[model samples]
Target: MGPGRYRFPVTPLAPGQAGPRPGGGPLAWIRAHPRACDTVLALAVFVAILVGAMAGPHGPHGPRFGERDLTVTTAVLAAVASGALAVRRRFPRSVLAVTGVCTVLELLLETEAPRAPVACSVVIALCTLAARTDRSTTWRVGALTVVVLTAAAMLFGARPWYAQENLGIFAWTGMAAAAGDAVRSRRAFVAAIRERAERAERTREEEARRRVAEERMRIARELHDVVAHHIALVNVQAGVASHVMDSRPDQAKQALAHVREASRSALDELRATVGLLRQSDDPRAPTEPTPGLAVLDHLIDGFVRAGLPVDLDVPRPADALPAAIDLTAYRIVQEALTNVHKHAGQGARATVRITRTADALTVTVLDDGTGPDGPDAPEPGGGHGLIGMRERVEALRGTVETGPRPTGGFRVHVRLPLHTTQATHQAGASGRSCRTGETG
Candidate 1:
């Protein structure tokens, strides 16, 4: 035998048998064998009816067994009525009609005071009919059964029309219908509860999948921003080092040093971003703080060293900004400056400006270079920098605009709420508003 394979004995099952269901107790056994249960019920009802037919209240003391003879006719009618109950669930109306006929005959043909025990089977049949049918049908059939049986017993029985036995027939049948209706209602209520629970389970699973997809998108955007900005710097420096290795040895050494620094920064940022997906118990995971607007000066210096001079204008806020807004602001500036360094022609200087209002913080990046529509523009589908910027802004309920400037340059502008509560307030009013023109 193969290591992953096994053999087991095959047992044959009887036709119409599906093996035992998973459960226990007497109720489970009854549910598994309904036909056998119905047979037992019929036997019990037959015995009770036969015993009742052999007893009478005409005894000197009270009702006594054998006071009345159990004739062949009485026994035959009792057997017929009880036998009909075996198929009550499958054909409730038919069973009820058969039992009612037997009961009518036993009442109308009796020579003495009628003690028709066959009516017991009719009671059971009426209950089954009501339980298996709708309320309107149950009501209609129940009223007819009660009226017909009670009237037959009153008008044709040896006893008077108002005898206690006549009225007892009406009471028993009415109670059976009510009990059956209650059982039907309980079953319906339980079914409704089960359906609602299943719907809630499906809803929770869908919500979990949606959140997982969003998180993946966010991580992908972070990895892209980190790699593109640092790798662009490294590429430029490596080119400079190779071009001047023989002619300008000292300048080549300087360019190589910048390349090492940019690569180191890239590795550190990548480790931190990737570490978020590791297990909490992993000891090698990095715990460095996320970069934000506070490091704007250092970010700009890297670009300046890479040969693209940049100008900065920012004022310190009175209070610290939220963590999400701070990170988004930093990434937007990093990606925009990286685009300028890579695509903007030689001597194409860039400018970054930050303005803080009472309720909002705005960031604007401009470069006097060949814009997206210019001859130097990269082909369509070249990058996702502008798309990532829009996604980050929209997540915080902010707005972003990207396009070619009128005066032969490119522009990236964004407005973010100062307070988290303000973002929540405006989220419904202007949902996911992002105005984009072209990618760099």
Candidate 2:
């Protein structure tokens, strides 16, 4: 596991486990019942029609279908239509076919007894088909069922072509189908919106995680560079101390002192690096100062001691630059000089220039040495020093340019804003005074 990568748990049934069953427990139980809800509704309709039959007159022209013994036949047709409702959800087309046939048979019987049971069954079948199938299928099935049943009633039944009972069947069936279709469409639309929202949320979370990981990696890289540079110097001094212990005891003592100083500095920087992991409110976490323009002289002296010819030419500023801008300028100069020491030939002369204006400050470093040329000049492949300088400057809403100068040398130019220069000046002055007192 690298420093920044995170692992999240995976659950197999997570989505399904997130909620109760789709229709609520009771509705789901009802739907799973052996008889089905539609069948129960159909049976209720049958009982109501039977009660109406028993209450009516039984003589000729008195709800008994004109003295014909039609009770058995009507009862059988109603029973079959009611049974067909049980399988509506599983086989909606089949249920519709069976109900359609039963409807025709009931019309032929021409019973004055109520036809509500048959109509109820037809409504259930149409609702099932409309809810389950696409609009095209629903239209085809609904239209065919309506046309056939209406034709049958007018051709063989006692009712007139436009009788209320006949028209009632058409209206109720159409309304049930339409209502069922609307419910299905609304459910589908809601589901689509929910899926899109979830996907967007997941994308945003992944992006946030990626950014956090990248930041951690950047911090790790900085820590590595700081530790490596300081430790290398300490190691060199310690070697000198060991080599001169007998022949040059005083020089060896001085080298040991330098080693101790280097070790202490490394420890402070390492503590600062580790302190980044602490919460913002933690008291013991270090609040290390960032190196800024105030440190330019020290930085130049280090390169000079390292056997590089450097000339620093910074104009006196009318006002102090912003802390961020000052830091950018210092780092740009530091990285440029470091590159000259690493890439330029021995004894190269480098010039650093800083110019401040009302709104912006520009820092430019030019080295007269046999550095990289042509396209290779801009590629700081092995080291991030130049890249770090560029990033620092740009983060202050500034610009940076680095390439081979036309005069057989390398150059880096940077411009930074001075919008917050006054505040930064006050803070830096107070901080510097405090640091000086502590050192004293």
Candidate 3:
């Protein structure tokens, strides 16, 4: 309301909400509310100035108040200026501009003796503006305000060129603006850091989910390979047992035994495969040795017992093979024989050939029976057996090819790296010669 002073709202004091004594006596209650603190401070300074004017000078440095109309006008203006400061935070820039203009006009109007309280209002407004705006804008606004007020005081006021009152106004207003701008910058920096931390946390969660999906895929592949090979073997032996039941009872009994063994093996492996879901505190699961090239003889014997005519060929002094290579070779042979059992009719013949080269082992399983084009050929179930075999060989850095042979049968060919530890040991101690190498 006054030329240089601020006006703040003064609601009736709520229960237990009154402030401390004025003039720095007890500032404890004002500390709880900063905006209220600013308003109270402005009011306190104005009241002190009013009281000082009325009491007159005690020392040589004290104020000299005017009488009559000048006194009345100054008092009214000071009251209005102090009152405006109550809403400064809600409209900092507007209040600062209005209060600054009024202070300059008042200095000019009261040329001989301007009021000190009018200058205090300009300081409170400048500080509020700095706290609400960015640093660059605060600097520009604060500088212009200080310069304008100092010039107005010097040009029109009754005060001397270096009056202490005028210098105090400049010092107090600049400090308030600087302090408020510092608080603004610190709060912004803290908020930016919190945002970055949240983003990093989200990225970490996404990476964890990707890893879980990849692990699930690996487990699914393993289960497919294990189930296909064992089930095929059981089906072949059961068919043989049924066909020979009356005419060859002893042979039929042996075939049934092989069927039971194969079924049991499948159940055990399936349980192990699915047990990955068990909780960590559960008892350690049973582990089974993976089938490798060394077990080819036993696998061939099972097919023979199931009534398929069989011929086997292998080179002597087999070279060592990598563990992955050995396992891949075994799986390829197992899958090929299983396909032959499923598709080949009664009295069909199969030949398993294993050749050793300096660098790799080559296996070929050929069956002379209804091939893919044959009308009575069995429909492939699940469709994953061949794919699983191919995947296994590829994992070991090997290759496999399967198709109908020119001789009216299906042939599966696989090449696996030898010189593996298992092959070397099996070849060294036994010194066994290769099996028969002629076509059946």
User: Which of the numbered candidates is closest to the native, going by highest TM-score?
Assistant: 1
C-alpha positional error of residue 428 in candidate 3 after TM-score superposition, expressed in Å: 34
lDDT of 2 by residue, 114-226 (tens): 34336667777888788777888888888888777766665665446676667777788788779768766765665565666666666767867755654565465446445
Which of 2 and 3 is ahead in TM-score?
2
lDDT of 1: 0.82
Residue pairs with clashing backbones, model 1? none
lDDT for each residue of candidate 1 in 320-412, tens digit (9 for 90 to 100): 887778888999999999989887767788999999988888999999987345574567666777877887888787888887788877888
Q: What TM-score quantifies how close candidate 1 is to the native fold?
A: 0.82
Ranking by TM-score: 1, 2, 3
- Tens digits of per-residue lDDT for model 3, 301-354: 866766666798866655556556666677667777777776766667998898
- After superposing candidate 2, which stretches have Cα over 4 Å from the reference? 1-25, 31-76, 109-116, 133-163, 228-266, 305-309, 313-332, 343-345, 354-363, 369-409, 413-440
Name the top lDDT candidate.
1
Cα TM-score per model: 0.82, 0.65, 0.57
